[model samples]
Target: MSKRKIHATDIFNLISLTDPQWDKHSRKFAFVQTTMHEEDNEYRSAVYIGDLEGKTIPFTTGKGRATSPRWSPDGSKLAFVSNRNEKSQIYVMPANGGEAEQVTFCKNGARGPVWSPCGTKILFSTSVEGVQDLQQDEEEKKKKKHPEPLVVEKMRYKSDAKGFLDEKNDHLALLDLKTKEISLLTDGDRDYGTPAWSPDGKSIAFVTNLEENPDVSLVSDVYVMDLETKEKKKITNSNGFYSALTFSPDGQYLGFLGHEKEFQSATLSRVWVTKLESGETHCLSENLDVEIGDVAIGDFHSGNVNPGLMWTEDSEGFYFLMSDQGGTGIYFGSLDGAMYPIHLPDEHVYAVSMLTGTHEAIVGVSNSTDPGELYHFDLKSQTRNQLTNVNESWKNEVELCKAEPIQFKAKDGWELHGWIMKPAGFEEGKKYPTILEVHGGPHAMYANTYFHEFQTLTAQGFVVLFTNPRGSHGYGQHFVDAVRGDYGGKDYLDVMSAMDYALESFDFIDENKLGITGGSYGGFMTNWVVGHTNRFKAAVTQRSISNWLSFYGVSDIGYYFSEWEVQGNMEDKVEKLWEHSPIKYVSNIQTPLLILHGEKDYRCPVEQAEQLFIALKKQGKTTKLVRFPEANHELSRSGDLALRIHRLNHVKNWFVEYLQKA
Candidate 1:
């Protein structure tokens, strides 16, 4: 049978595998398998166990979403977070397969369960609002028929993901298995997360911003707490953002991934190991130019927990994920500050679980065509064996396009990386209308990952070209930080240069019927691109930024993000912000633009799209705005299934309407 061409709605049929966890003593490993419930317009996930021999089976089942699977120290019990009830709570079951038991009944909810070294306790995070009991909190919430007036006081009062901020703050709690008692380990207005237990179980290391006004600062420090004395010591000074806390096997060093805000968000996160005895800190990946965590942006995967510092049994070295040259790979780092690649394949390794005392690991790998799957990887041999085919059925039914990697020089002679996907069922000597796709983040790389949007566009007979420009990660620190203060300057030239290189090098591309699209930072670029030049015939901007002046006050991270990226703020560089804003050049746009945005997006809020659409319509230039209700900035990635489909269809239809036909 002939395979069918991929469609925008094909996302519903694909499965995502993430958060792989290996049982220390056994060869078996468990991973979270997520699939879209099309009928319900929701995603359902369950934990599945897979062995090195390639056999896989579900460990958790029935309806509600389950995620963050973690094995106990003895590998006898499995702990995970599920939403089978009204609120998501922790569930623990025997690793050998039996009935699972709900472990926590926190009033707000509980998640991110970390099994204690002794297996006698579990460390989890939950939101708390003071000394109120669960019953009282529920009763108090029920009494309020309507939500009370949200009196916003702090600058960080809302988030694109969590919505409006409440009085409750996320705090760490300790659950005693034998006594069935739960105790709050840390409390107050400050939020805490990413908890790691020492091998001896006497102390816990977690990440938090203890600043009095943490809403204004971006610094997150790592803190270690003594369980017996409840004494807390700050390991990192208030200098940068830090997370992914893990204790070495020997309990002598606390390893983590962080940056010193040298380049703000564009700074490469290095591997830092702090000696507990002398308080000496060392950056293991200081010499490496690649980003220390997974920065490959894709739309298919869900709940992809980065395997930060997976230390070996000897504690001399650890494994980590690094993004370099448009791909994410596994690398090893030693205490003496040496780094080496373990498996640097031309694919995306989203999650990994290394077996103790061995070089073998269960890694979740994905590429341009494959959605994602679990693989038993041998780090020493640098070989991988497929262990699970979660998206096999979808792959068999649909014909996917593979992206061919391309390298070219930017306008200023700097080398850049990107990929081009040929239109589905391409014929020789026939020129195809091409769409230049720009990824968001401006700091995130467009790597060799399964991007549903790219496939859908290619299936619609449009060549998709995506690239990592100056602001993108995986490149050196200087390249990543190049676009910080020069938003539409060199970054714009880089993308335009990519299009120029593609048109000059490839005979199959139709330069006249060109189109452009992007979201978030990419959206901002799309707007900027159209306003600056009429090179493209069509454009689609999603969750974009238009005016830096208004963006600094409206967006959730706008105040700081604008200050960091635009190098200006309302206070000192007001004129500079306007000069860099795309809205300032609205009258120059000639391309027919489609403005797509989430109604509830706080990152590049809907108003950004609204401002652009109104300006275009007032000028009598072709433009349309489509907003997805109840959606946020993540509409393209992890939003509602129906909304995500609608978003893809809107983008595909817009490009097809302007770029295709006679």
Candidate 2:
């Protein structure tokens, strides 16, 4: 097939494949497929079921989203959630073939369903309206007037997507199949998540933050409730982050992904197991030293539930995924604390499903060239077979850059890893302008996954480069925590060192015409780079942090994120915060900069971008600000479809004006 240049518009055509679940008795596999609707800027999801060797067909079809498909205990019914109406509601149908019926009708709607072991009832999570709020709403409806003002008293008032939280918490509800009645379970002024039913069906395990001030304390514990007695037993302390909870088939052990806050926000999620008899809890992956969650960040997939711990039928060992060195791989962990990685290099295993009896697995993985697709993996043989060709159109049409791995030593003697992507069409004698891209999280890695923005830049004849500097996951504990309190120190040199290695080792890269860009922490680095050096001609900072001092007071994480990562607090460490802030060095910036921000972003609030843009503009330095409405920290990854393309255009044009030849 002849190669063609890819565009940002192609983003809509991509179908995100995720949440593969297997029906053991029926031998049918179901997964969620989502595609973007450009006009309305909405992503529509549908559920699909396929056999091992038969054709794949859509089980539910609609313009609305239908996701999180799960087969019942008997394999006779499929349960899922759909947003066919305003809010997402639970729905179920026969697993083999039948019309899906909406199961729950609620004001806030229900999602994330878990079926009972006997398959007679289903349980899901839904937000509960406070008694006062519900009465106020009713009064307002009767009066045919505007709603009354929301008087919220919580520490955290507004969230990113849900908007003004206003005294609402997600609680559990149990639904009866025969009576079609719902029983509210675990109701309080707290949020619950990830419900799991024990094999005996007498108990339900869930996670909740029952603290007086949940947003401030940020403590969640695992709890198991007796179905008949309604007695709850708390299994964890109020110390750290814990989620992805599951119970073994034998109901003898509890498995979950959590960290003890020993490392604060930089702590990697470890697989923890608790023996029900002894009440002894220990980390299985403590020695493995890798993040135990999805670390591959990309734009294609959204609305993913944690795969958690998938136990074998015998309950001897369990299968789980771990992130290491820019890729996610399935690993087998024994009860004896032995762990071994099932090597899946150069791929992001975003989701995985398995059959109970055998070493059979189906994984949703995406690489540099592929968007996302499911693969039939043989755990015994450690081989994977392609199960779906969902991205064939883009694969056949685009001439994408293949990433080559590179390693270099920082000036401080620390070894760093990175990848280089040459432009689509490369020639020996030509020099191409290069972009040094940085990823967010500061704790996240730049993986070998398909990045649409990078692909478009390569299509525009620019060599794109990225690296996992210190403070990035995939590396060990120390490396991922190195940037704490030393933001602009060695980590700054690590990225610049990658740039130096790229210019020295790759002859096609033009050192004189370089550009830099990043979002969140990456944006902070972009601002830092342009201020410290004039090597880059242009830069773009998106959803970025400019001043740690102001950020510590304004951002949603302002309360503690600064203290955790920047080692700064508003009351105690103001001076240190200002010292590492990029805004402090803005006067020395020589590179023309473009500031992109999401107005609704609470994490790295738009005020951060505003301060930087205002500072650069007042200094008479060349700078521009591009703001997207109703967008949050996830703007680049999964924002409004139209605005995503617009943001990409702004980025492309800024670099085109400065880096590309006339």
Candidate 3:
């Protein structure tokens, strides 16, 4: 279509569609489309409405970002979260569009708005300062001085993005539309969130860690409170990780997505329906052998939340996106536990909403070649209709490479799946430098989705190879959990086997000029690869974990994740941690490595990169560490726009230089 390949900086021109909500009458849908502002260093989001005929209209034009749109019961009003007034709070406005009225003014602001069926009240969640902290802040404001020191009392005092949580805790609150007043329905020492109102409006179901030693267990349960009695009772009675609580329209069942910790964090999330009368839970897709929800790993759409369990109009079934092998598609699940397939290939459905009246759905689908766009699928006719061409003009202006799927076998004869992107505007019989990229989450899947980094390499005349190794989602539970307690085991070989297959099968690859790069868990593997083999002439590891002993105590999920995956606590199994650590095998490395890390990346921490750099330096090995200031672990996805572009340039420059030199 054009004479030019897609530039790496084209990521800025892409728009991300998320949180699609259907109106009550099913005549239209409201959703959020986000775009990045380089100078402002923020993602600007706005709500929009579209009809069944693909006609679109903007619903809100706030200067700041907005999201989480919820249509009112009668479809006359729409409520959403916006930061236009200096804080994220709930706002209600006419469904057709008009001036919005702010509903909640809590100190910490409000979000996650859920409308009641009666339209008399709105339910939302907000964080509030503790009693002592509130008093201290008030006193400081009176004296016109800054606040005092931060006192930490919990094991988890800080997080990766919202660092240093201080003492504020999220709690459920209710807003009365008639009086414009807000009241606290539930509050205590612990936090409460993900509130869903009962069908009859007599009860409210919410999630919390009210268990003993909430910090140690890392488990959440659904609790329903009787509005009249002000009493709450737990429905789920197991040590399972649960969220996305939705009560079936008939009010007889509570539907959710959860796993019983059989395989811990690596366990495939299955769909479950709980009987409200009997307290019985049935896993609808237990034998489906695929993980529910979109596990499509990529760098384009940042800050997207899963809108779990979109129920059908009749409430007899549900529609959800399932990650399988390398593709993610939408599937239907019924109340009787029967599943049906609605086929769409090579597309990742990240965010979706259904219009029940017409037996159709509005889906946000994307693939390797496409950034993403909204589509309406007719269930009765089994056909897809394009609703928005958000990236059509940009796509026509540039040439993008399409991914070709490949299958290979590991050393143990395990089948592995991967995709290779030939260099953009390829010429037959001409060899090109190859680059191997690994995804971060050992449990996350590398789906057939848009990957800006991979495309960037293809634009650089490099064939990109990416695989869903063992421990990656989109496979069965056993396959996904196979990497646990064996970090550098078959998972590492699976990736290597993928590369072996590519080099052996594709004659257009220059194996001698190979390079490797990854971040997070993938970064750990990149370090492992350099230490074990000298095949790659250069390597780049980003936000990597070099030592498990320090990772256990420093990371946000380190303490528990280390014990669950590594199979033992850091203190009890010091030898195992060091034995599998890449730092321990640093002497075998010969490739020139580049360490990229965010200074504020608390998930892996900059210290991990520092330790690996110092180890390579002490051994007189070639390495360089580049630190990004004020960036977190999500630098590649939703950090400062300038930093994101620069990071990609750094990676591209490193590979180009080393591959050419080799």
Candidate 4:
């Protein structure tokens, strides 16, 4: 049988695999597998176990979603979070296969379960509203009365993902498995997360901001608490952002990933290790040019976990994920600030789990043609053995396009990296319309990964061109931070140069029928591009920013993001902000444009789209606006499956109408 070309709706048939974990004995792997449920309009997830021989089976079953699978120290049990009861809670089940047991019954719910070193207790996090712990029945009864008004006082009162925030704060709690008692460990008005237990189980390390006003501060300090005396000591100096806490096997050092806000959000994250006894800290990746965490952006995978700083058994060195050039790879870093590559293949390593004492690991990887899967990798030999074929059937039935790596120089002779995907079933002598796709995070990299939208466009007879501009990661700190104060300056030249390079290098691209699209930061760039140039025939901007003056107060991160990114704010630099806005040059836009946005989007906000649409319409320009209800900023990635499909179709039809039709 012949294979069929991939389509936008084919996303429903594709499977996503993530968060692979190795058992204590390293005999089996537990990972999360998710698939689209068209009837329910949701994604169904379950935990599955597999061995080195490629034998895999479901560990958690039923309708509810399961994720964050972690094996106990003895390898006899597995702990995971599930929403089987309509509320997320921790559950435990035998590793060999048996019925799962519910462990927590908190009023608001719980998640992120971490087993103690002795395996006798489990540490989890839950949201606490106040000092009183209201009974579930009483809470439901009160909810049946009147709706309470939300009082907003802080700048961080709302978020794009969680929506409006309340007085509740995230706190840690301990569950005694033998006694069946739950005790709240930490409390207050501050939020706490990313907890790690010491080897002896006497101390707990967590991340939180203890500043007088945490709402305005972007600092996340690591603190250690002594369980016996309830004493706390801060590790970080409250200067930067820190996360992914891990203690060395020998309990001598603590490792984490962070940056000192040198370039604000565009700063490269580096690995740091602190001596526990002497309170000395050293950066292990300070001299390395690459960022020390996974910054590759993709729209297909869900529930992906980045296991940072997997320490070796001897505690002399550790393995971590780093973004360099155009890919995310595995690297080993020592305590003395030396780095070495363990595996630097041109593929995206989204998740990884190290087998404590050996040079072996289980990783979840994906490429341009494959969605994702798990593999057993050897550090010494750098060889990978297939462990699961979850997406094998889907891969065999569809024809996908492969991204060809392209490198070129910017207008100033600076090097740039990107990829170009030819249309599926391409012929040498034929011409094809090309679409320039921009990524959302000017700080995130466009790596070699399976992108559903790119494949769908190629299958529809359009070539796709995507590149890492100056602000993109994996290209060192100086390159990534170059676009901080200059949103449309040289960064604009870098992308324009990429399109120029593509037209000059490839003979099949039709320059007259060009189109462009992007979301978030990419969306902002797309708006900027169409305003400045009329070379493209069509354009689609998703969740994009149009006016910096309005964006400063409307966006969730705008109050600071505007200042950190564009180097202008509404208060003192109103003129500068308006000067850099796309609305300033709206009269120059001659291309037919389509605007797509989520009604509930707070990151870029729907008002941004509304403003741009009104400006273009007022000027008698050709444009259309389509908004997805109940969708947020993540509409293209983790939003409702139906809406995601609708969004893909809208983007495809807009370009087809302008470029392919007369």
Cα distance off (Å), candidate 3, residue 390: 1.5
Off by over 4 Å in 1: 133-144
List the candidate 4 regions with Cα displacement exceeding 4 Å: 131-135, 138-145
- Cα lDDT of model 3 by residue, 58-82, tens digit: 8888578889988999999999999
Candidate 4 lDDT, 182-231, residue by residue in tens:
88888888889999999989998999998998768879999989998889
* True-structure RMSD for candidate 1: 1.3
| Per-residue lDDT of 369 in model 4 | 95
* Candidates' C-alpha lDDT: 0.90, 0.86, 0.85, 0.90
lDDT of 1 by residue, 54-159 (tens): 8889999999899988899899999999999878999999999999999988888899999888899999999888645322255665774866799988999999
For residues 386-433, write the lDDT of model 2, one tens digit per residue.
Answer: 888888876888787887888889998898998899998889989999
In order of appearance, the predictions have TM-scores of 0.98, 0.97, 0.96, 0.98
> Cα RMSD (Å) per model?
1.3, 2.0, 2.1, 1.3
Going through the candidates in order, what is the number of backbone clashes in each?
Answer: 0, 0, 0, 0
